[model samples]
Target: MLALLRPALWLGSCLRGYHMHAASTQQRGDTSLVLVDEARRFIQDCLLRVGVSPSKVRCISEFLVVADYRGNYGSGLNRLDYYLSDLQSGHAKVGAEPSIISETVSTAHVNGNSALGVFVGNFCMDLAVKKAEDSGIGFVVAQQSHDIGMASWFTFRAAGKGLAGIVMSNSAPTMMGPNSKSASIGSNCFAFCVKGEEYHFVLDMATSVKDIGAVEWAWANDEYIPHGWAANEGGLSTCFPSLALRTPLLFPAGGHKGYCLSAVIDILCGVLSGAQYATHITMDQNQPSNLGQVFIALDPEFFLPNFMERFDDFCGRIQNSQPADDSEPIRLPGELERMHMNYVEDLRAFAYPNSLLTKYKEVAERLCVKPIELAFDRCQSRKSF
Candidate 1:
């Protein structure tokens, strides 16, 4: 009888090990794709099937995947679930077309109608670039848009069109008062793109010490957030009474300077647009309310002749500036992202956590898409970093 039980126990352990192996392989599947065009096509088809228009779907898929290809998973493919949730909850209307709500000789306001931000943002930026080309300058404001991917993408669009672009957005309240006990502000972000001589310069940053997504990711991974990294007991401000609180206010990057810019962005993106501000608005995420965004573009010709040439010269000087450390060279804002993109091209896929892999499988199942397979051959080669 004991021998019989031993065999059964051994079988059970082997089954558990098999499951673990499958989970591990699924998570570690390579993200670098030798066949990137095929992957893009696959993603586009998937998005279209879910009700996004073909053109819009193409742009959205590219925007999301660019982040993945750059190793910014927090803002990359990992965010698809959030978009799906918004679609299912009626917070985002798939296939909704945006319209110009107001306009001036040099300015326009757009109503996104709860459309995906990627499409709406691209549309607005394109309009801005066209206007700038004709009028020497253009300004655009959009409301009722859902979370747009990286602001740099929009700025780059403007740069490609020979215009300087500035983008801003107000996110759900995630910060607390400085030295206080209450939440008082939003996680605001700002970005800029300017056509340089050799390469365009792009700068993008969140006002918070780190993005809210970073904090959320930490929580998901069962990691403890550092003090001054989250809100305190009441979530009213950026202060904490003790270190044991589950959440604490996130400090602003660059201290008061970032805090000030955050306030400015909230005013422009939220107040000027007549949208909810700071803690008053709701996020697309199922969590408590808080969200907003803003974008602005400028034509360099408005200020100077041979603007692109001058800009390039300025960037060249900055690039050649002495490095603070000899081991690391100075780098422009978008240089890291560019390097990451190149790295992914050589290595086929990204390495994700086992838990994230499981979640991806679950999401795929819910959408009726084929589950991602668990095998090394299905993985992409890694680029030599």
Candidate 2:
């Protein structure tokens, strides 16, 4: 069992470390540090102007802000354009709500009615957590939702309530499946979070060697991704971001194993939820993605005594493990994201790439909303520029 778990453990460290470097160039130039409150308000105002409901803006803005705050820039406000475009194009329904199609004590199936991903995800996950609170476990699935940002957002929500959280989503197809010559599955990302006495353990990742956002970022920044991240339609590895983005047949991480896992996620989120699957789902702004997602929550207190005590002991053993690198210590699943979130909070300002900031301003202007207010001067309490 330990051996089987080693790859996942290693991947958690490697993915988090790689994200720091991959998104490093995105931290400087054309960027401004703004108070977190300012950022949240900016997003809320923009969404409001773009026809999002007043009641929904807070939840959506906070979700995106948390993504940026956690250093997951790919799924952060950088993705705001996608949402705006979808809503503008009528791909996502404005002021829409999901309806429960079927339900039991601990499970539910919902139809999002083409609502924005953030709203559907929040609604469904909150329902799942409430059910877990009442019944000790909950499972919820939804269809016809747009992009849900990061899966961890939902898992962390449950974790915040002292319950174990698990989430999975099937995105539009961009991954090359095992033994196939073309794209056959979505990136099929997933997140799992466990509540501990001190910190929550979160393992959130896509099953791809690299998500499409990485390729898009590389294209935008004129950078090159390392080999094995993507391939051409002919199935040949390529480092050219243009080709990778144009013909995004991304490699599955861990080869066949990752491919298999992605397929299973699609089964649960797509097939089981009765949402669009495989090539039928499109990521283009001209069409609704019709994404599917599942959220599960389990209350440990209902199952065992000393759950937190056991969690702490289990995590302590991993943290105390010998480190092969002198500069880096072993970390638990969600520790890296938690540490980054804290680091950003400690600074009291979040940094974004100049390009993304510019795009945000452009979108705000297009929507007839005021430009985002950026904090321009540095202070003893927080850094800005």
Point to the candidate with the largest lDDT. 2
| Number of clashes recorded per candidate | 31, 1
How much lDDT does each candidate structure score?
0.64, 0.78
Query: Candidate 1, TM-score vs. the true structure?
Result: 0.80
Give the per-residue lDDT of model 1 (tens digit) for 181-242.
55577768788988666876778778876666555444333334554555656543332223
- Residue pairs with colliding backbones in model 2 are 30-354
lDDT of 1 at 291: 41
At residue 270, what lDDT does model 1 achieve?
79
TM-score of each: 0.80, 0.87
- Candidate 2: give its CA RMSD in angstroms: 6.6
